[model samples]
Target: MKVLHFLSFFGLIASLSLEAAPKKENRKPNLIKPSETSQTSIENSFPKPKDQYQIRLIMENDAFGGFSDQYYTNGSRLEFNMKAGESNPTRRVLGYWNDLFITPTQSTKYLQGFSLGQEFYTPTNIEKADVSYGDRPYASRAYFGNSLTTATEDTSITTELELGMIGPSVGGKSAQMNFHNFIGSPTPQGWDTQIPNSYSGALRTDVRKFYHRFFGTQYNLNLGNIQADASFGLIFRFGNVDKTPGPGSSALQPGPPILHEDGTGYWYFYVNPGGTFQFYNATIQGLMGSDKSYKTQNRNTAFSNWDNYLNNPTQEAGEREIQYRALAEDNGKNSLQRYILFNEFLVNGTSNPYNIGLNYLLFNNIFNGAEDIEKSTRLFLLNNLAEQWDQIPDNARALAIYSIFRPEGGKLPPQIRLYSYEVLSQFILDPKQREVLLQLLRNEIEFRDEKTYVADLKRAVGFIKVGFVSVSNAGFLFGVHYNYQTIDFQSGKGLPQQHQWLGFQLGKVF
Candidate 1:
């Protein structure tokens, strides 16, 4: 009996000891997978500590606007950026502050931020006589957004809304003419029947002034070794004109052209050198966007603004006189006259021209950012900048390519066997051209050990991104990435335990 009692006492003690021991929590901190980022992706898998702040000084060349090196070479951007409030990408409740400056084209003298949204610039150099007929200030030169991985590690899709010059003109400057009319559209019987419109007998004199509004959206996608980008947008024009024609009419013009934006206005027409026109100095208002009809009170005054050399037997001119032959069956209506002049302008090749389109996906990049993998290729479509991609002079395109690919010290890697420096250096190029080349070289020179050269290439084409992950629970560690280029375990390397050995790294957080 005494032996049994002792055994019972010992068992109770053992049970108490087992119950006293601590329990291991079921939750484990998330760790970063190798495939989520190139060399620069956050190393930690768990969410970063809350309320952390990050500031970065950004000096980039010609990559943010689009993938092409030629898109923004006219100016280099220098931005002082700061992000505050929450640091979680899943719930990015943060505010941004930035002081972005650009030289030459569209320069900003003040600091900017998320609170500021965007700022606009007006034409201040109006004193210059040749300031270009439609030279106005613009606010859409630069764009800013999250530089971190907003989506889960395996895939990411980022969309950006932008305005102003969406991308660079391939060969030269492009022009679009916007006409804003203040008068209403012609009556059902047409302006001929309306004896006395506001500018009576003035002929298609509804146009008062001209101004334009443009908006664009760009989308970037990252899927393992492939990255794709595309953009689309609309251009709008608003005038003081009402639907009806004739004196003192406040209603907008009633016509064939489809009105938009709550039926307030419509897109006039897209113009290029090769485009055709049926009339000049004529009122274009019909169901279709391009309705060519002539109604002019003074023809000579209209042609006077233009060069006299254009006057010829076929396309002649007179003082406030109709140049083209008048239409028949007029009801003694001196109020309106219709003339036709089939014409198209011969654009000068030497002069820089522009091509405007409703949408564009001309360029994108696809590459594997894995340190050990081979580099991917760049993709180009037949139509970039909404124009024939091949139309750009080979020399010009060569210069652009050189600017993007030339390595550090302006040196081509010895491994590259094509095109010697002597032959490639012949064409004159912009100074900003070399900056991108330098960035591309930096990847080969600095990050080769990290195996992030492909990521560098993505960044060279204007994919800006940055992320942070903790380094072994000490503190947070982070690095900014220009573009998204990361490998995935399921595809590239498979499960890490198979190829990548477990290892321990000792480091302090920044």
Candidate 2:
């Protein structure tokens, strides 16, 4: 019944998004032309001046949508855009980077943009003082971005680089708390468990092609620790639209300046429907190879027993039994302890071949070192491994295992290999024996054929934006948009699957 309700809601939104705008002939024609008026003139009596520079301030807040404060809560950006030329520092820097991928043509006009932005996310139950393991983590990202765009009449290509910091230093906690106090909302309690501070950088490239005045397609590729995904989508526009170099709106990001040839006003409604192939999202899954400790357990003592067991092999069976019992006592107290126990059980006493396959699968796929493999595939494989593990042939497993650990080349991180060595070193005692055991474990990872695992993280996202751009004869510009987006990720229990926000922009042409 709940699924049906969501489906119905999405259907209604789609209908509204695709509604055609009223025809121009249906509207009353303006009889007077004013030199300066609050509203824009449909027709310009004189030639419009070319804009050389633009500065814009953009703000987005979910509170405007009247939704709960969870997930993507708030964001803001300040942007400056200018014509790209040899004298521009941003153009000179990004131009060199762009040349590596695409050579600019003579007809291509270049525009450079620089921006500073901050965005933050929260879990469903913000009032909870403890971490919510099943929900998305609390995260904040503040970045400075520089981008270069090359455009013609029908198409545009943009390459952007963003460098920033993620975590408490970004002031997400203070910002949210202060705002909540101002609005008389419940204070978020889980910010103490937010993702730790870390340096982050990402490269993003977008290509947009307009097939007709009102229709176009856009493709985007993003790579970095913060997000890794590829997306393709179609764009539809109606009402009074202009011939912009790229997508008319930057959505949430900073965009190139709009070129208004006649300094007149224009307004449009647009719908963007798209699907993304997600690879990794550090904001949800945590950073790769990060050693930061969380509030879940006592970091110093969480693995003391396991470490002791690995460091001492000559201990009596009775003594080993006592250590194992101690671990059992600590289990269920916290997430970290439970995880350790699970790994230990798989390593010491799991007789089922299927369970053995699962152990290797969890370690290899979850802690993947390869950059090309999709991180979401690990979740899919784990969910289905039980039903399919027995079907894999032994010889195939051998070949796969051999290929993964060829001695001369392996992609596993040094930290993971070292951790594995520490665990085995105690039992093997001898260096040579331990090396052989490590190789055997690596071979076990190939039990299921690599080709058998399929990625299942593709999700469709829907966007509806209704906005207007007005440029005064004096070169002033202002716009406001109401934006709505369907679920972008798989929401956890008791979480909203849709989000909406409002954006306001104020700019000037100099």
Candidate 3:
């Protein structure tokens, strides 16, 4: 029965796509007449300006709906797009590779896009410290994506590839906990049980065709370690829609803005109804399988030993020192500790102070032909520098140190840049100073750059999305959307079978 329903859904999409599309003569004219002499007319009289490039930011969160904050809690992406032409390196490379596999199709236009995004998922009850058995696991993915789109009069096709990492290494825990702290929400305590670290990638292709002026059909296939699925959908547009030969805006789908021949601007409301057939979901089922137990055991042991050390009553000075050193080493290797450190490194590595200290550390340790230093020794020196600084009361000596470590403006070798922040952090003592370092590190991270289950899983899931888009003649764009999805999995915990969220988008074209 489930197989029949899924096949029927695909059949419906196929029939919809085959419907007689509106002819050019039947379409309403969007261009102004030259005789009207209106400002828009005057603008149209000039050669149509080409929109060669665009940048977009997309964000989605369940909290925006004023409802729950679990299961696909939050997501964000930044994307850059360009008209595909000989001048574009990404287009040339990807196009060449594409040609080797499938013959190129003739299309009126092409676009190439690149993006970086992060999203995290949690169980229904985020406040619980224990794993919510039979519910979704705490998981996060940070990925880089590349896409190529080709469009004709009333159709567009997009092929995209995404590569990323999943687990604690991606900083899901830090992102959620810190945000919750800022917002006064209960901290999510079960991230220690998040899926083990692993690399993930996906390839997806979508084909969409419009019928008349308001209706369209789409089909897509996705395959990867992260997920495997096929989906079909219908799209409807109303109001002052752009009749351009290109892709339409989607709040859930991160990509380039629709290319317009003239900067006339537009406003429209759209609805998309879709269904997906799932095969796999790594975020819920996990990729590490049996190895998950081993990793969890190690993490638990590390935390347990650290707790013991902190509460121990033995007070021998020498023994305490030895224990402290050993604990620091162990904590350094702890998954949570590493997650925090990774986030800190990414968030603080770009500050002037951080870079200055990093440069100095690199110069001494790697570039100056000094004796090679062990990573542990370097870590110890960096960690203890602030304590050492407190003993030196001479302000002149501090100034001298700052002057010696200040950045001189040449790029450091790329290999050591990510690790250099540890040393750089040693120089920062004030809370505000540390904040400055962290802000820079985050800037660099940004500015620089599913599995299916079996009987517990629904074979088909349906979703609906409604949104409005507004664009300025100056090329600025903004949109807000509401999305709802039918349950794709059965948790049997009285958790809601329906989930809804809000999405926001902002973009600019040049």
lDDT of 3 by residue, 176-257 (tens): 8888888877667657667778898998777777775578887777789877888888888886764542334443454335
Q: Whose TM-score is higher: candidate 1's or candidate 2's?
A: 2
Residue 139 displacement in candidate 1 (angstroms): 6.4
The number of the candidate with the highest lDDT is 3
The lDDT for every candidate, in the order shown, is: 0.20, 0.57, 0.59
Q: Please provide, for model 1 over 1-510, each residue's C-alpha lDDT reduced to its tens digit, 9 standing for 90 to 100.
A: 655565567568867986997867885664855354323323342355442222222223223333322111122222221222244332242111111111212211111112101111111121111111111211112223232211211111211212212111211111100000122211111111111111101111111111222211122222111112221212122223322110100111100111111223222221111111112110111111222211221211111322242333343234212421121111111111221110111112212232311011100000000001011221222233326445544544553354334321112222221122212222212345334333333333332222100001111221212211122233322212222212111111111111111111111212
Q: TM-scores for all candidates?
A: 0.19, 0.55, 0.56
For candidate 1, the lDDT comes to 0.20
C-alpha positional error of residue 140 in candidate 2 after TM-score superposition, expressed in Å? 0.6
Q: After superposition, how far is residue 368 of candidate 3 from its true place, in Å?
A: 57
Candidate 1: worst-modelled 10 consecutive residues by lDDT: 362-371
Q: What's the candidate order when arranged by decreasing TM-score? A: 3, 2, 1
- Backbone clash pairs in model 2 (N, Cα, C under 3 Å; residues 3+ apart or in different chains), count: 0
Error of 1 at 197 (Å): 33
| Model 2 stretches with alpha carbons more than 4 Å out | 1-51, 87-89, 96-107, 245-251, 262-265, 293-475, 486-491
